[model samples]
Structure formats: structure tokens, C-alpha cells
Target chain A: MTLTVRLPGPAATVSGRGQRWAEARAGSLLALPAAVYFLVFWVVPFAGAVWLSFTDYELAGVPAWTGLDNYRRLLGDPGFWNSARVTALYTVASVVPSIVLALAIAVPLSRPGRVNGVLRALVMIPAAMPLVATSMVWSAIFADEGLANTLIGLVGIGPRPWLTDERLALWALVIMTTWKHLGLFVIILTAGLQGLPSGVFEAAAIDGAGPVRIFARITLPLLRRTLLFVLVIAVIGAMQSFVPAFLLTKGGPAGATEVLPLYLWATGFGFERMGYASAIAMVLLVAMLALSLVQFGVLRGGDDG
Target chain B: MTLLTRRRLLAAAALTTASGLLAACGGSEPEAAVPADGVPRGKLSVWLHQTKAYDAVFTKLLHSYVQEFGGVDVTPLYVPVDKLDAKLLTAFAGDAPPDLFKIGGWTIAGHARKGRLAPIIPKAMGVPDEKALVAQYDQNAISSLSYQGRLYGVPIDYTICCLYYRRDRFAEAGLDPDKPPATWEEVAEYSKRLTSADGRKVGLQWILGNPQWTLMQLLALVKGKGGGILSADAGTATLASDAGVEALRYYGSVGNAKLSNPLSGFGLFATGQAAMVVSGLFAMDLFPALNKQLVFGESFDIAPLPHWDGGQPVAPAYTWGWAVAEQSKLPYTAWHFIDYLQREDVAARQLKDASLLTPVKGWEKLPGADPKAMEIMAAAAPHADFGPRTPVWQEMAKALTDAGDAVAFGKKPPERAAADFDQAMRIAL
Candidate 1:
């Protein structure tokens, strides 16, 4: 029961097809630059790094196929494990405090006011400055008689070798990193809070719920997605952090601050062991990916719940 | 071409470009350029670690060379001392290293082994052969810049470590201002007396957290105790020996670890917080420069580096060398410029202007040299240990630093620290 309705002429069809083809070509031409960039900068290096991880490629020599030898070596490499442990500890220590403090600060700052606006700008000043500049400023602050010790001394604590003691060095870096990154997260969370539906909090308040209860039952659950985003990003940034440790400590005070990135850099550039460094890099990449996935799953699952 | 075909072509071209870029990092040895004449004639790139005094002398010398040669154009890049090694390594990896550069003596073995350094061109240096060139400088200093029995560089800014003490601190501690600790035991006794109850003032402070200085400091102690960092053949770690443990124990016994100065005890010594510091000849000039009130003779003076009570005296030395890159297109020109830079008259000028000893023969007799400091250096020159010549010096240095810090910070027993160093080096070696 095929019945043909009045259709466009062949000439019309051809003109339409030609116009569509031209549009497709233009779209492709627009995308060509970005596509080439992705292929050249990102994909190629990633593929090369993965391949190099399986070889014995010192910077000065030809790469020789070593199969699983480099990866196998990582299992027994104490430096690698120490760096991994340091990275994990540093991530947790810095990220948790940073996110919590940011949220706490953001909650107060979320309300639109001129004073809050001024305070927000004041908070973001550290983030607006370059990381290297902040790291340098923090180096002076963490010195033996610097502000950190001076503040502690006010409470009767003696001056500690903040950057020189292994036990204290990582924590010192954490303190600095937290201070440097805190403002950005606060701004993020403040934006997230502003974007949230106001009606839920208003309804909760009208139902005789107190501010604390409203926040616990309403604000938090609503802000879970934003919190997850902040958490994922903070964790990734901490994991990839190199500047503070490198500039201040150079992975010293007995390797307390030798995070994975610094160790990878030392291995690759300092020791010229490109292959092993690449393997470490791949592991780091995998770890970051897995962590991001878990964060997504946990947050999405909470949404389902 | 068809649209789809053109897209594929673009993708292929992108892939090829990426592959070529990656492959370019595989370093290649540049062909050596033959000398046409004694006068240098080409563009030359020179890299140096920035030092105020040394830069002044070097810049003048560079300008003089360019003016004298007339045919050559010279471009100089001064990197910070800390960043020079990494920058040089990166340059090497990219096959775009400077034609000539100033590098540390420790890097000689590693860089030479990797075929990154051009061997000595005696003809360009106006010497008959490597033998003549070796005769021109102190043998120990010159030999320290060699690898695989081939000379790769000329020594500049050579310094043997010595003990620098504050006269004021010595007098304050009820010790004779004219006398200084001559042995490790005396140093420990002096340090105890000099250190204040508050622990801010300390004596004999080790430079904490610096690998090169840490290695040098520990090397002297370990060697003085009749132990060596590496086996004679440089194939194994021998730092766990009884001698090493004893030396480390002695190291741990002295020096207050709480004193913090980024300049490595030198700052402390300059500021009157530390009574003594182990330092190279450069500190003689550096002390006064660090503080205006600190005069060289009245406030601070140097003594020979202290040895273990019953051990042979050892003065650990390190040298910075001017080397030509193996990949340099103007190898001959680079060598010629280095030769001009290392002349005896220029060496004297370097001493007068920069306090940089060129380690040339008869350097002690140079007019501008301090008689007392020169005497100490001359006396110690025979015993100067240039440290272990190994291709894995960076790892070795880090390992030594770890062991040294462990002992200094009271984190581990001397025996355990030395053993851990051995274990670390077993993997590195």
C-alpha cells in the first residue's frame, strides 16, 4: 500500500543535497584544527609514552625492547613505592581539609552582599597569584623563624624545622598547598550554592527545621554533585602537584615530600631513565582515571538513592 | 582530491609530524668540525651558571675573545646554578646543547659516558697534545675532569674544602681566637662549647639537604676514617664498612640539627649563629658578601679541614669545568675560546676578580691569592680526593645525602644509616 504524496522535484532534491554537503564540509574544516591538535599533542605523546614504558629507553641511547622488565622493576623499586605512598598521603591530607574548609567558607560567602563580595575577592587573591610566587612566599613562611613558627610560638610551641624535618615537611607542604588552593574551591562551592534551588531550603525552614537541620537534610544533599566535582578536581590537583615540593624542598628532608610527579621528573630528567619514568606516568594516569570513575559512580549512585 | 581522501591525508600528515617530533628527541652525535686556522671563526653558544663575580670576569673574557677573534659571534646564556644541570640535560636530549658550557666535575663521567661531551682538542687549545695540557694545570684537578682516560674539559673555579671558623665565636666560647679545631674530636668539643642553650647558635653545622655539599662533607669524613664511598673499581658500595659507621657517628655527634639556614650553614656562620662551617674557597669571598659587618680576617678565618683524630688528613675538592658539547657544530671554535679563557694571565684575573682559583700550576704563587688560604690549599692539594668517578654520580650523591641527613637528624643510628646507604647504592649501582 505504497502511496506517493506530492514530492519535491529532482532539481530541488539535488540543491538540498549539495547544500547539506557544503555545510558538512564547512563543519569538518572548522574542526580540523582541534582534531589535528588532539592527535599531535595529546594522542601521539600518550601512545609514545605507553610504548616507551615497555622499552629500555634512556634519553642518550636507542630504545631497546624490554617487554615487562620496567613494570616488573616498579614492584621492588622502593623510591617508586615511597613516592606513591607520599602522593596518597599528600592527596588525602591536602584535599580533605581544602574541600571542607572551602565548603565552610563558601556557606557564609554564598549570601550576596558587598562585604561578602569583598571577602571573596580577598580569598581569591592567593589563587589569582601564580603558584610559583605563592610557593616562594610560603617557603619564607615555613622557615624556622618564619610566620608559621612565630604563630606556633605564640601558643608556647618552640620553633620547628618546618621544611627540614622529615616528620613535618610533608605536613608543611600540605599546609601551604591547602592555603594556596582553598580560595579557588571556595569560589567553586559558592557558585554551586548560588545555583542550587532556593525553594527547598525555604520549605525546610517553614516546616520548623532549624538552620543546622535544613543544611544537613537539604543543602548538603543538594550540593552533593558540586562537592563531588570539587573532590575529584582537588584530588587530581594534589596528585599532580609538583611545584611546592620541588621549589621548597626538592623532594628532601629524607624523601618525605617526594611525591609521584617529582619522583617521575627526577627519574626521567635527572637520572635520564625515560622508560621507567614513562611507566610511572602510565600508572599515575590509570590511578587518576580510576579515582575519577569511582567519584562519578559514588555521586551518581547517591543521586539514584 | 575527494573530501574524505583529503581528511585522511590531513590525519596522516598529522601522525607523521607527531612521530617525527617524538623521534627528534633521540639524540645524535654531531660531526666534529675541523679547524681551518688557530683563530676561531663561527657562531658559538655558551652556557654558564650565574655567579656575580665569575660572570663579571667571564663576560669580560667573552667580550675580549669576540673582539680578538673578530670572525666569531658569541652568545652566552647564564642559567641559575640550580637549574643549569636540568637545562643542560634537556638541551642534550633535544640535540640542541650549547657549543660550550660550564659544568660540574661530577657530571663529567655521566655526560662523557653518554657521548655528550667533545674530547679535548689540544691543537685548538694551542697545546701540542693532551699531555701538554695536563701539565699546564694541577694534575688532580685536571684528571678529575677526565673519563675513560680521555680529557673532556678544562678546570675552572677549582676549590678544595676547608674549615672556616668565626674568631668572635671562638673567643666567646673561652677558646683562643687564634687557634681552631684541628681534628674531629676538637671540633666536637668546640661545637659543644659554642652551641648555646637555646640551640639557635651552633658550631660545625653541616649543610643539610644539599646533595653535592652533603656528599662532599660526608666524603671527607668517610675517607678520613679509612673508608671509601665506592669500591676501588667503582662497581660496588663500600660505605657500610666499620670506618664509614664510625665517621658517621662522629658526624652525628657534632652539629645542632635545629639550626636552619637556606644557604647551608654558610648563612649561619656569616650571621654569627654558627661558629664553624665546612666550605670551599668561594666562601672566603662569600662570607663578607653575605654580611657587611663580617670582615674576613677579624671576624672569620679559615683553617685546614679537620680530620679524624688518628686518621690521615683528607681535603675533599670539587671542580667546575668548561666543556664543549659533542654535538657542537663549532667544536674547534669552542675549544679555542675555552683555551683563551683558561690562559694564565686570565686565570690570575679570575682569581683577583672572582676569587676563583683556576687550578693552574703555580696558582699558589699568583699575586692576588691570599697567602694563608693558598698555603692551606697547597698543603691539602696532595690529599684532595675528587670523590668517586662513576657514571651514576647523581644517584650516588642522593644516597649519600640521605645517609648523611639520617645521621645528622638523629633519625637513624650511624650503622643503620650507612647500611641503608649501601642498600640504596646496591640497587643504583
Candidate 2:
């Protein structure tokens, strides 16, 4: 009101500086709760797990320190090798097809329309369903007299034990896991596609680019970031898969479906070798870390380009 | 000093606030609510593998106890049978174990040795007449449950392996409906005769999925032939004994000779694709549903488990039971429930409802039991054998199963498999 021109005086400068510092301090304080939470729940638990890995810890008693005994045993154990093979097969089987199937569905579903909306919702229903519930339903369907076999019988195919047969049980698990996880992949890919710029596509069309050419050249390159994110998540998810195999197969028909997690569970819980279980867990953690590092490297390499 | 700086600061603060909100929103479901009464509140969970009948009975029993007790609540959790040991070990290690749980006879010793089980005698529920009770239970089951002179859990029920055959199918094959096979050779002949080339059916099924059951039955046969699974002290594995090798070889021969439906095991039995199967009493209820004309009998000819040449009949019986948790704060209440469950009246009612045999004394006399059950009880009462009392029983059982599977699948000769089994047993011990 007085039309005073405030000059950049020392007092004004000092007050400004003080206010900025106060605001930054407030912001840091606001972030403190979350930082504390992460440290307490995640960082601390991880540290404990790492420490436990080196000990002969059975849950009931005090843990004893054993240097690399568990790891040495793991190296020589046939069970560990068998489990590693199963985990790798489980990951490859589920991840590759899941990505391909998700891409196939997502590209078409990205287009906006009433039909697309309904189809997308239907596809997402499996992802929305609880995993344990899905495993249970799949278990029944793969049973000897389950609906799948009943369907097979219509084609004059004799009943096969999808969940119980040694040869087929792991495959059945892979199928069920793929179905459950595919929807999430489709949703992620579809989001990436939707967020894509339309100008580039229009230009591509004007330059006489066909739909396939546009997708291959324009869409895929732009979607690299999202694809990398999905790939990393899918691999991690595959490695940690437990519920489907645990529920449906229980690592049976002669341990045909025994994945790493199940093997760890058996060692820790079944045999009461907590120390050994910890060692297995540590190995799994290390493997996951290595895989994540590879994914990080690829992501960084893509970013550089 | 400047509006732009203030606005930027506000925006940064808001973004941080939003992220905090998201983090809170994305957290997992909260832990189960602690009871307000604070009666030493902790999770009182129980793990079981049995579905339907067993689940219903145990769950109902726990629910009633919880209702009566009021201070602590009991939660019943179901695990698959094969995963029970693993799951229990994990849960116990997590320090969030079920207050009370069940394990197979073969698993008790291992759990006991690890001291995972709280001693039932001193801290938890104490059974009256522990020796007599143990004797009444399957000797093998009791032996497996015992560790270093300490009895861990009470044996709940005995699971006796028997032969389930289609009575109607036997009649069609021109075999006597009243008489089952009396010996291994007779079983083979009957199985072959019953087999049809129709695309849908097989002759007889053995449980290949559960190799332990097959091994135990084989051991029973060996003992019947005057051979044993181990020395009297269970200090060494006698699986490579002449009787043991012969017994396993016979089982392998049956598979090779196509006298038994090796591939069509439980699957075939469930779908009525097999005429005969070696199964347990627990599955008897489903047989009638699978085929209305199903008949139950002992392993051979409604007698006890088939004898070897001149030896007495020895049936292998597997048993499971309830035990109070060592960590249970409501030990008195848990014991009260256990004592209530063991009463003759309560035991009979539960057995009738669950279609399970009772471990309580004189409860077997409950009226209206199938005559076949009475026959089994009579035959099994005297000569039933159990595995060793050492904590190595689970490993030993696994070794046995592996040996049995090798023999059954023709992957290894019975003698070699038996020797391998003996090596495993020594390692376990």
C-alpha cells in the first residue's frame, strides 16, 4: 500500500536465508519418519538375515557361529543342485512366455474403445485375484478328475496327473503362475503404450510407415524403459515363486517340483537345520542380487544410449 | 523473500507428504489384533495337513476350547501333508509357531531332538498312564515319538494299511467275493485276472506317491519272514538282510511282471480304474463314493498283513496325535481339552464323526463299526510293529522311501537299494 521498494539489504538478505534454511530443515524433518521406518523394517531385517546366514541357528535355541560350514555343505549337496535346476527352469518357463503373451495382448488392448475396455478388464481379473486362491483353484483343476482332465477326456486323451505326475507337475505350476502373472504384465505394458506420444506415430504414418513398422521402430524403442522395468520385476518374481509349487506339488512325485524356496523351507523347517536354511537363504539372496545387478547394468546402458 | 521460492518449497513438501501417504497405504495387512484382556497374549496357532474330516474334528475341538477358555484364541492352519515338517520348522524358527501342532510318527523324533517340541510331561499336558498309552498306540508310532526316554506327543490315531478292492469287480472276474488273496503269489494272480485291456482300467494299484507306506509294508513282510529292519537296539540297518532283500525284490517283481498297476496308483484307485489298491483306512470313506461295491479287507484275505513263509503276521501301523505346546500359556486349559478329548465317550464320538480309530482305551468297542475294522483291530492288536524311537526316524523314513521307490521303479536292484538304505540309516543315526 505504501509502495515501498524493498532493496536487497543485509537484514532482508539474512531473513531470506534464514527462512530458506528453516523450510529445508522442515522438509528433512518430514522425511525422517519414512527413513526411520525403512531402516527399522527393511535394512535391519536384512542385516539380521545376513548375520544369521553364518550361524548354526535353530529357531528354538541360541545360535552358534559356524564358518562357511553351511555353504560348504550346500556346494556338495545334490538337493541344492536339483533345486537350482528347478528354479531356473521355473523362471525361464514362466518369464519368457509371460512377457510374450502380455505384449501380444497389450499392444492390441492399448487402443481405446468399448471393446478394448471390456477385454482389458477381463484380462486383468486373474492378476486381481489372490495368488493363494488361484493356486487352490488350479490345484483342483489339475487333479486326476479335475475339469482339465475332464476336458481332455472329451478329446479321447486319457487322464494324466497334471499336479501329481513327476513329469507334468512342474509344467502345471509354470502354467498357473504364468496365468496369474500375465495380467500384471499386460497392465504395465498397456500403461507404457498409452503414455506414448501420438505425434511420433502420426509422423510415422505420414512417412508411409505401416502398423507393424510403426510398432517395431517407433513404439518399441520408446517403451524400452517400461520393458526393462517389467523384465527385472518378472525375473525377481519368478525366482521367489513359492505358493503355486508349494501348494500344488509340495515338491513331490519324487521332488520333481522342488524349487529353491521349497528346498530352503525343507532344510530349515523339515530337517530343523536352521543354520543350513540360513545358508540357503543367503545364497538365494546373493543370486537375486547378482540378477538385479545385471538388470541395473542393462538399464544404465539403455539410458546412456 | 520471494513467492517463487516459497511456492517451490511448498511443492517439495507436498510431494514428500504424498510419498509418505503412499508408503503407508502400500504396507501389508496389519498383524492380527492382540486380545484386550492381555492374558499373556500371543498367537496360538496349530498346523495340520489332514483335510475335511481330520480338519473338521480338530478345528471344532480347538474352537470349543477357545470359547470356553476365553483368554486365548486358537487358530487352525492347514498345510499339505508333504510340507508339514518344512512348514513347522520354518514357523518355529520364526518364533511364531502354532501353540499346538501335529506331526507324523516318523517326524516326532527329529522335532524332539531339535528341542523344538516343548516337553509334554513337565511343562505341557501330562498324559495319565504314559507307558500303557504308548503301548496302546502303534508301537512304531510311539517309538518314533520317543526321544532319549522323553515322550513328546500323544499318539492320536493309528493309520493301518489295508487292501481295498472292488467286490463287484472280483465277482465279475469270477473270484470269490468273500475271500481276498491270501499270499503275495495269490495277490499277483488275482490282480492279473482282474486286469482288463479296456482303455480305462488297470488291475491293482500300490501307493508309489508315498514311498514310505510301501517301505513299511515291505518291512512288515520281512519281519513276518523272521527278518527285521534294524538290530534289537536299532543300532544298525538290517534292510540288506536276506528277508529284506527278498521282500523288496518281490515288490519290484510285481511291478515288472505287470501284476500291479505301478503308474495307476492313487489316481487309478480314485477313478475306479484299478480293481485293487494297498491303501489306508482313512481313504475307505471315499472308496464307496468311487465305486459303491467297494469292499475292505486286511492286506491279504481279511487276515493281518501277509506273513512271510512260517513267521507270524506283522502289520505296520502309523499313528498321529495331539500335543500341548511347551510355550502355551494356557497349559491347564490345553490339558483340560486334551483330557476331555481322551474320554471314552468323547473319543468314540470323534472317531464316529471323523471316521477315525480312537487311541482311548476301550473306545474301539463303540457299536456299529464296520466288521472289517473289528477284524483289523483284532489282528493288529498283538503284533503291530513300529519304527525306532530315535530322532533319526524322519531321515530314516525318507531313506526307506527312496529305497522303496528305486525298487518299485526298477531304477536300482533291491539288494543294492537296501544297502544304500542301510548307509543312509547309518548316516542318519
Best model number under lDDT: 1
CA lDDT for candidate 1 = 0.89
For candidate 2, the per-residue lDDT at B259 reads 22
Cα DockQ of the candidate 2 complex: 0.13
List native contact recovery per candidate, as a fraction of 1: 0.43, 0.20
Tens-digit per-residue lDDT, B210-263, candidate 2: 546765667676777778777778788898988889877877654222122323
Off by over 4 Å in 1: A1-26, A302-305, B1-32
For residue A239, what is the lDDT in candidate 2?
90
Off by over 4 Å in 2: A1-24, A112-114, A143-159, A194-222, A296-300, A303-305, B1-103, B116-145, B198-200, B211-218, B221-271, B281-303, B307-313, B328-355, B358-372, B392-429
Worst 10 residues of 1 chain B by lDDT: B27-36
Error of 2 at A136 (Å): 3.1
Model 1 lDDT per residue over B1-429, tens place: 666688899999999999898788654554356555456798899999998988988888989888988999999999999999999999999988999999999999999999999998999988889999999999999999999899999999999999999999999889997889999889998999998988888888988778888888888888988899999999999989988998888878887765667886888889899999999888888999999888888999999999988889989999999999988878989999999998989999999888899998888888677889999999999999988999989988887887888788888899988887887787777
> TM-score of chain A for each candidate?
0.93, 0.90
